[model samples]
Each structure stands twice: as structure tokens, then as C-alpha cells.
Target: MELLHKFSFRLLPPVTFNFNHTRLASLYLSTRFPVSGPAFSDPGPLFTSRRPLSSSVVSKAGWFLGLGERKKTSLPEIVKAGDPVLHEPAKEVDPGEIGSERIQNIIADMVRVMRMAPGVGLAAPQIGIPLQIIVLEDTTEYISYAPKEEIKAQDRRPFDLLLF
Candidate 1:
């Protein structure tokens, strides 16, 4: 349970969300959907795209990543617990920069690192990127390894790779 607390969703909105009504919370989010910045408080249109998202812009790797390169490993190291970036609010990603190569690589790297950590979710700042981006996966495989009581207590379930 301590491990789960450490590696659960790292960038949930400050406001509590009621997901009992919809399954969208577990779905993969695409950039084509218009975003309302970091403030999810506004009860307005979040996604306005009318066309299907391009496959190239979306990561095939299935999660988020951070920027910067480390020769020692393919994925960036997870920032330690006391890092300032972890406590500070990260800047929202610029809408125009979503499709850039750098962001794409970051997403890819984040996915790799998250899987390596065997965590359910990760934030960009976890990998040293100060952007308001996050990736999450709650797979059946992960669930199988946990105690039934803990899983029931946490309401954890298998969800697709979710990135935004």
C-alpha cells in the first residue's frame, strides 16, 4: 500500500472529479481535443476538434514522457521526492507545441519510465519536465499482483493507457 501511494496518479486535478457517471476517465486522451488549459474548474467546452486525430501526433508508446537525455538509460530518472519541481505547479503545455518532436519524445520517454517503475501513473515533473502532462495505466496485469483487499479499498481497475 505504501508503494501504491507513492506511484499512483501524480497529476490529478486539484478539484475532485466524480467519475461514477462516465467511463471517459480511463480512456486515452488525444491532442486533437481542445483543452481548457490547466484550470479544469471552468464548466466549458474542453474538446472542440471535429476531425479524427492523426496517428503520428499521438504516441504509439501508450503513455507520457519527459524531455532531456540520459546516456545511462533510455528513460530519464524519476525525480526524487523532495525536488522543488514536485512541489511547484507546472506550466500548462502550449497548445501549439503539442505536436512538436520534443513533446513527442518526452511522452515516449515518460511511457518507458512509467512502465519501468511499474507504476500506475506518472507526471512530467516526475521525469524532470515541468509541464502539466501526465500518463496513466491501470492494467489487469498490475491488478493481479496486488492483494484483493487493497484493490477493493482503492477501487483500482484495469484501464487503458491514459495520457494528456
Candidate 2:
């Protein structure tokens, strides 16, 4: 009889970014040792190792900029399993109320709390409101391997609103 143990390895997808010729040239020039005379003058075959090197440079830049990083904590919303808010329809936001400074402040505070709790998503009811507004930060996909700086630079955008 043979004994076996389960094992798995997660592979990260390659990071890619759009860069034009001039930008690539600039990056290559900046990172490589300064050379006198016109640089890249006798440009060797276009198939030189330049492409891979440039890719690595850009990958490092992306990592530094937190382009695809994830947050550190796994703070899911705290709604209890039997909370009624889960089943109840969310309230609609009045158009006039949407742009008020108070509403904006609330949104800001919500973002702060979310960050502190390290939660990915939060509903108004969870925070004691019945409004349809929701703020979420989805960093699950990038959390495991993304650098800290990259995770901090992550951005969030809202989608369509759900109304009761």
C-alpha cells in the first residue's frame, strides 16, 4: 500500500502593461548604465534581450505602484447569518440627498471604517442605515501575492445602485 498526501501550488499570472516605443526607450535608457553618444544607435536585432529586460523593469514598477496588490486582512462583513437586512430590500437614495456634504462625509467615514476593519464589502444596513448605498473593496484576487505598496494603491469604483 502506498500513502499519498495532497499538495498544490498556486501560480501567479504574469503582469503586463501597455508601453509604447518612446516610453520603452526612456525606461531602458534610465535603468541601464548611461552611455555616451546617441544611445541605441547601432540598434542590434529587434530580437535582442531588451524586451525581457524592459518587461522586468516594468513589472518592478507595477509592484512598486501597487497596481495589482491585495490588502493584508480578511475582514468580511459581520452580518450575522440570520440578520433581516440580508433579506430586506435596501432603501432608495433621494436624488437631492445623494450629493449633500453629509452624505459625502458618511461615504468618507464608511471608507475609513472599511479600511480599519479591512473588510472587502459593506452595506448601509450593516452600518445602521437602510439606504441602498454600498461601499466595497475587493482585494481577494490580489491579496496573497501582491506587495504591500501595491495593495495600498488599489482603487475602488461603484456600480449600479439597488433600490427597494
Candidate 3:
């Protein structure tokens, strides 16, 4: 029994085999030690010829590569379309009002809300306030690929409305 055990272990050496070697060895071993399990009872087919998948498979690959999903932009509630306040011209905000602690607190709050909404620009009118106050930030500035001359011309405009 010990000799038989040693021979069995020797026949199935534990060397790591490449894919082709593994397949060939499995084929050789099948003839040597034919399994009598339910899985191999009928032996349906030995091998099926494998060809590259059709162009339909390429479509699946292209779908993943293209990333065909549009990003949704979220705007602030106060500055939405059809708001009466948005139509009304903004009132003049005194520099003194801007310096006030209350204004500072409001600005901080607005900044927090803007960050949460991920907005590029926010106006006081959007927040139900008629004050002529606005803040803007753009996250796409770094990757924007506009021409330098055009960007400079846009910078010369009254407001910095160029989207980087």
C-alpha cells in the first residue's frame, strides 16, 4: 500500500504547469485514470473549436470604453428658472453691508451650500434675496482646452463668464 501510494504521488508530480502543458497533461491523465463520476458519465464532447467572438462582442467592449453616461448638473434652488426673484434686477449691496458680521456669516453659509450643490456660480436672487451679491467657482478650469488668445479676449470682457 505504501509503494502504491508513493507511485501514485510520483505519477502526479506537483510541478506548476503552463496552460498548454496543463491541458495536455489532463488529456493524458484522462486516458490513464478515467473518472467514473456523474460529471463524466456520458462524455458529451471532448473539445469544441474556439474562435474569436464576433463584432457584437466588440460593441460591448466599445460601450465600456466610451462610458456613454452623461453627468447631471445640479443648480441652486433660489436661482432656478421661473423664479420671480431671478427676473427682478438685483439691488445694490452697500460695501458696509458686505463688511458686516451678518454678511460674512451669510457668505460662509452660501459657500457651504454652493459646495454641496457643486455649482459654478450663485447669485443672491437665487436664495430669495434681492441683494446684488454673487459668488462663482469652476471645477473645470484646469482641464479646459480653449485657445489662449480667445481666453484672453474673454477675460477682457466685463464679467469673468468664460467657463475656463
Candidate 4:
């Protein structure tokens, strides 16, 4: 490590933390390497991973973004549990047809319905579209409870309305 640093390479300090979140309270680590200004470009572990909230725990009446709204939004008919179409491979989206109006409309509808389903992701096959397109939701909504620095560094990526 010292040999690399003699040529001006700097190693960032490792994370030190004492987390106490549900299902993740026992971890405690302390580590450091005293190199200051940025050289290496890895911002490691801003947030700790925890077990997901169980559906049974977050029942229908549970907090929905603190609003406590109970009215369920409608979702497009999800492909049923044992549909043959689901087993069949989805068709690969044609690269040339990507920007076409029909494809755009399908993508828009996929995103809109995915939001109402409140899912973080949806594959085209899941909605009975035998195409390879997929849609994903923004992750920022789930990171509100993360640390300020973590949020700032969280790379709030935009959800592509559609992807193949």
C-alpha cells in the first residue's frame, strides 16, 4: 500500500458503522486508511442493506408513504399464475422499431401500469406482452430514510420508461 501511495495513489478509508435498523442491528465495524483527496473513485457502502419488509407486516392498511390511503389503484391484468405464454420466450424487440409511435405507446402504458402495481420492476412477459421490453421504477422513493451523504451520492438514476 505504501509503495503505491509513494507514486501519489491514494486509498480511501473503509466504512465504519454501528447500525441498528430492524433485522440488521448487530453489525459494527471500524476501519481507516488516512489518505485524503480523491484518487480512487469508489464511494463504498453509503447505505447498509436490511431485510425487506414482509408483506404480512406491511398489510393493506399499513403506511403508504405516510398517507395511509387504502384505495387500491387498478393494475393491468397480470399474466395468470400458469399461463403457457409465460413459459414461451418473449420476442426480442427490434432495434429499428424502438422509436416508433406504436412501440412508444406500449412503453408508456407499461410504465403507467407498472406504477399502479407499485412494483420496482416489470418484464414485458409479466404483462402478457410477448416482447423483451422491461420497465423499472425509480429507486429514490425507497431511499428517503438513507443518510444525507448517501442520498447525495446515491446516483438517483432515472427509470427508463422502456428497455429491451
Q: List lDDT for all candidates, in order.
A: 0.80, 0.61, 0.64, 0.67
User: Residue 147, candidate 2: how far off, in angstroms?
Assistant: 13
Off by more than 4 A, model 1:
1-73
Q: In model 2, what is the error at residue 30, expressed in angstroms?
A: 90
Q: What is the lDDT of residue 118 in candidate 1?
A: 92
Question: What clash count goes with each model?
Answer: 4, 1, 2, 0
Of the candidates shown, which would achieve the greatest lDDT relative to the real structure? 1
TM-scores, all models, native as reference: 0.54, 0.35, 0.38, 0.43
Per-residue lDDT over 40-107 for candidate 1, one digit per residue giving the tens place of the 0 to 100 score:
54757645678666454453434443222224556689999999889888999999998999999999
Prediction 4 TM-score vs. true: 0.43
Q: What stretches of model 4 exceed 4 Å from their correct place?
A: 1-75, 143-162
Model 2, residue pairs in steric clash: 66-150
- Give lDDT for model 2: 0.61
| C-alpha lDDT (0 to 100) for residue 75 of candidate 3 | 37
Maximum-TM-score candidate:
1
Cα lDDT tens digits, model 3, 1-164, are 99988877776676655679889788778767357876678868554558655455565576465443446544335556888887888888777677899777656656666657756666677777777777766554522555678768766322333211
- Model 3 poorest 10 in a row by lDDT: 155-164
> TM-score: which is higher, 1 or 4?
1
State the weakest 10-residue window (summed lDDT) of model 2: 1-10
lDDT of residue 66 for candidate 3: 46
Misplaced by over 4 Å in model 2 are 1-79, 138-142, 145-164
lDDT of 4 by residue, 34-133 (tens): 3563533566765555966545446455445545445665555678878877999989888999999978877877887777776667787787888888
